[model samples]
Target: MMTTMIRVVLPAHLRTLARVESEVRLDVPLDAEGRLTQRAILDALEARYPMLRGTIRDHVTQQRRSFLRFFACAEDLSLEPPDAPLPDAVASGAEPFFVVGAIAGG
Candidate 1:
């Protein structure tokens, strides 16, 4: 199995929960087809920071939380499928995957 070092930037609240002050670095394993997806990243993240399990995604369904959004290379990836491959920049650690807290209506 091939692994890639992915850089993930978490929101302040989640950073506090995970006791991390800056961006997180995770070693994520690529799928059989050599694809690096959000699921792979999140799985590695949760495994390293168990406290963030339900904060980013539902514990049971493993779905993204409604109040959060995903972005990479200035593009919104929240609507993308979990199994979809991420941008090469993200996979190559050139760009960080951002987990931003969504802002709501006033």
Candidate 2:
């Protein structure tokens, strides 16, 4: 069976840190069925982009890092559960999964 693929865009720093040239590609399971979560996707992403092992979440605790954020459809999903269903564009493979860094300085 062939699963749909999704394009995920990482922060510039992460991309450079991960040493990836282009966006990351993820394989959506056949039965995902609108369950656009970040955990599985993140896992798959890390598996593919080994250099990004601990960019989003911690390697040991698996908890989201300090300033990492997940966004889609112009909404912030950093607080959303990793297994939560993301926007249709993301699930449908139209948009890209974004892992951005949060900056808090005035």
Candidate 3:
């Protein structure tokens, strides 16, 4: 299996939980078609940082947390399919995948 080095930027709380001072670097394996996706990245992330298991997504359902959003190349990927290919910039390590904490107000 081929692996790619992916950059993932976590929210402040998650960064603290993972004990990471800055963005995380994960070696993510590509699928059979040599495609990189969000699931692959998150899988590798959780594998390396076990403490973040349920913080980013639901452990059982594997769904993203309601307060979290995904962004890459200035695009919102939160509504995209997990298996969808990320932008080339993100895949090439030119940009970081951002896991941002959303804010809501009354």
Candidate 4:
């Protein structure tokens, strides 16, 4: 197994909740057959920062929170399958995975 560094950007509220001022850097474990996906990233994020465990995803179902959105390489990844491999740029750390808070108003 090997570890790869992944960069992540959290929304302001989440950052405050996690007590982080800058982008988060996580060392994600990768096996020979493991593909870099949203599920993998979220698992690593919650593992490294337990405070964020249920913040981004449901603890039981592991589903993304409804009020949050995900993005990578300037594309909306919110509706993508969690197990699908993220963009290469994101997996390579060339682009940061983004979690943004969604706001709805009339």
RMSD of each: 1.4, 2.4, 1.5, 1.9
Q: Candidate 2: RMSD over Cα atoms? A: 2.4
Give the deviation of candidate 1 from the true structure as CA RMSD.
1.4
What TM-score does each of the candidates earn?
A: 0.95, 0.83, 0.95, 0.89
lDDT of 1 by residue, 18-62 (tens): 999899999999999888899999999999999999999999998
Which of the predicted structures, 1 or 2, would earn the higher lDDT when compared with the native? Answer: 1
Rank order (by lDDT, best first):
1, 3, 4, 2
The TM-score, computed over Cα atoms with residue i paired to residue i, of candidate 2 is: 0.83
lDDT (C-alpha, whole model) for all candidates: 0.95, 0.78, 0.91, 0.85
lDDT-best of 1 and 3:
1
- Write one digit per residue (lDDT tens) for candidate 2, span 1-106: 3456888888888778877767877796534464656777887788877888876899999999987888877898888876777777887788888888777662
Instruction: Return the candidate ranking by TM-score, descending.
Output: 1, 3, 4, 2
Once all C-alphas are superposed, what RMSD does model 4 give against the true structure?
Answer: 1.9
Clashes of each: 0, 2, 0, 0
Q: Provide the lowest-lDDT 10-residue window in model 2.
A: 28-37
Alpha-carbon shift of residue 27 in model 4 (angstroms): 1.0
Off by over 4 Å in 2: 30-34
Worst 10 residues of 3 by lDDT: 97-106
Instruction: Report the error of model 3 at residue 64, Å.
Output: 0.7
